[model samples]
Target: MDLKRRMQECDEFFRLPELAHLVPQRRRAALEQLEQTGGYLQTAEEILIGAKLAWRNHARCVGRKHWRSLKLLDARRVRSARDLAEVCWQHLQMATNGGAIQSMITVGPPRQPDGREFHIINSQLIRYAGYRNGDGTVIGDAANIRLTEFATELGWRGAGTPFDILPLLISTPDEPIQWFDIPPELAREVELEHPEFDWFAELGLRWHALPAVSNMNLEVGGMTYPLAPFNGWYLGAEIGARNLSDTNRYNMLPLIAEMMCLDTGSERNLWRDQALVELNRAVLYSFRRAGVYIVDHHTVAKQFCDHVKREEAEGRACPTDWTWINPPISSGLTPTFHRYYDPPDLDIRPNFVRRDFSGDGGI
Candidate 1:
């Protein structure tokens, strides 16, 4: 969350040889732009809003398809990490053609976050820097087709059943850049290694020359559940990219991750404990590449929950009723205490209470 500190770390990290020489001025410019653009945290916050929308959409679709089953929808469409990287690369290329230089943003630990860290890069400014060959034949188109072929060959699938290809299709190259091409050796490898390459070869389409650009937002969340305190903590990160090119293209891929520590103190009630368990499992199943850490809830939640009890216990005031109850409820003889409990409020019970983590209203 400390934007300035993280930016400084990023500045130092990018100074390494592999990444440093690639874009020295651009890197400095990005750092300066990050400062002038209101720092990493602020920019990340804005991107989070968009990522949430994307996450919600993905969640809804997955829920609709397999909410009944405990098993999550498989993301075979996004199967390999390489597939994601390629999509990101195309998106960056698209942004470049739009006359906007791309900026990379990272957040979390001095190294990497335990949960998820969202990233957003400018896609409109970085130019495609045209792909060329030693022989002078354009290679951008060849590269694009090869990327898609590689993805197909990998049998990649996104999260969910029958994994919606829409995200990938939209995220893939969107424009036709005559200059962007792939190398012959790489193209040959695709043809040799992937059986699907036969289809491309038969179609007479240079499988390696297909253009790709991705302009999609990503939202990933991670959480940990503790049994003792009977509560859960969550961390979320998100990023959005817009492909400016007609063919989906990206120059670089952003790597993201997150971590969460859960408190489980007030878990006396079996139902509450069950809720916490389900919540944790759900989050794990939903987000890949997320790390979770658990803590004793009783130690943490004791500081938060007023009362913790098992279902058998009676005379225990519902925590929600007390927390939000505007006027003290009074029995008719006393004053009519129960009437103040809104119908909705009466229906809803606090099975679990959070302790350690906080952000965006516990979505």
Candidate 2:
């Protein structure tokens, strides 16, 4: 992304009444800076609002209703990998907020003119280590198998548990890849238990409290920050329906169905469907029982619909991806699944872009 060119095209950056008058001046300065150094630094206000606008413009997110509440942490001056890790650690604590789970983004340094940038290897700040065994079995989240192997190659080891927290992995232009153990206290987790199922706790299922995506690049105005980790609280279906129940991930439905004595002899019995609902119930119950912030799919879908209405009232188009904005389970039951929306526009500025996990064997 080129900041100079983006400045000329994206008027959202200068849309605020406070910044409107300075658009001409800012645009001129950005062009001058680009000619001299091939980049321009964004002001604090620009970064802050830009991050929020990015969230608002993210079509896949169902939680965009709370975009204005996003908190920003400017760490653009962080020079070393260790310093980046330290700030990321602080980001976890702040975003977790003792389970209140504040929405936040910590912007690391922008990609340099030399084409080098900082990187956070883990897709999420906290993820279960996935150990792929020689026998084709997996011990943890199957989705993270490559990441676990990458961490192990870096000399990090886990207890070989089903839900071991993976170490934070990062890399810099000048340094080799590095890993750090999240302080035990900072790695908050909620033990899963059904509110009424006495044996559910015995299943020993748990998930980390935070869902920070650390590997995406934040593209605001014309600058791209490769290490801007951001997070919000969980949407229960994300964990219950996709993470745990997905066939390739934890694959917990079969065990849970067997435990529930659900009839599995025939697809007509809808065993997987039954297990899915119960599993989602357990997840919602567990998080709420543990005082962690989480929302049920129905409620979150309603909020998204509401957000779309608000955006319409403002004469702004709310771009949305139908598949992503709808809940994975019982999507037809929500209002979000009932209507069409503006298709996602990839050209939107102040957006978060997924980082390509290639080279150096990084995942």
Candidate 3:
């Protein structure tokens, strides 16, 4: 279906009986008030309807019978306007699931504490932020750093790993920052440097990281902050890279998968799987630190599926693994280094010695 027809279908879907309950009456009332106060009523209607359908679909996918039951939109528990906005976000997620799009752009705060390590991760996040489309066209404009500097000046501490940065870069309270483009080599360097940075290594990756960054950025009221070389190289890389000749590779799906492999181990055991999972967790942490959502694997898979669908519709041969374009480290781009030292495992018990001071008591 065409974009307009699909949108119309989406609109009609919201009016369906099963989905109508998902729309909050208060939201409708608020929109009406805004419209009376000169808000664009038609636009508001489209937004509200879209939000309702999105929430309904999301809830349904998760086997939820009502929108109120979902943590994202429970009115009784919703605390802020941001939380309310997530009700609309459910639509983006649903769209991805339905193969309508490969990715939905979002902006937020870094997932790591505001420190050197966070800055490194932020740098990598900046690199990925440059990811673009085919035909040498940019995706979003370059991410704005002035707002980030402003937030830092006002003392906003960020959280999460690199991937989370996208949201923050895109969603600063001021004007929207355009997405920038980065060269592949520079992107690699940023990834390598991220883990080597200190601030990130100190706090250690934890489950609560992303949420913490998001909460802190929100609390600080969108002030700009001072980001180190992370922001600089990111911007430089975006300016330096040429657009990919092939449109299929533009998604950078393989790059993400490759990074995932790098962060994990190869042993054929639970430890290996666990390590890989940690890598995934770390990536999410990094993205959160960068002030963006870590679009889950399920979302990425859906995107890949969408690409396949599009290729089929266009009567072109769809490559099964565009990820191979970047090539894996094992394929020889990285140099091998042997360990200089291997420490032996040892177990020791502590013993206490009593000191004798017979003459000291008398003194």
| The best candidate in terms of TM-score | 2
Error of 2 at 305 (Å): 0.7
Cα lDDT tens digits, model 2, 71-108, are 98899999898999999989999999999999999999
Candidate 1 C-alpha error for residue 19, in Å: 0.6
Residues 192-297, candidate 1: write the lDDT tens digits: 0112222212321111111221112232221111111000121111001112111243211111010112233344433333332333333223322222221222
Most accurate candidate by lDDT: 2
RMSD of each: 23.3, 1.7, 23.7
**Candidate 3 stretches greater than 4 Å from native:** 1-11, 18-46, 58-66, 69-203, 206-266, 274-363
Looking at model 2, the pairs that clash are 3-222
| Model 1 regions more than 4 Å off | 39-363
- How many collisions between residues are there in candidate 3? 58
Q: In candidate 3, what are the lDDT values of residues 1-363, reduced to their tens digit?
A: 133332333344435454455556634543444334322122333333333333222210211112222222112222233432352244234322322122221222222222211111132232222322367544422242333443344354334232323332222222222222222222222121124334333433222111111111100111111111111001111111211112232333234334444442334434433333344444544544554333443443344345445546756333232232111212132111111111211110000011121211210
Reference-based lDDT, each prediction = 0.25, 0.88, 0.28
Q: 158 in model 3: Cα distance from truth in Å?
A: 13
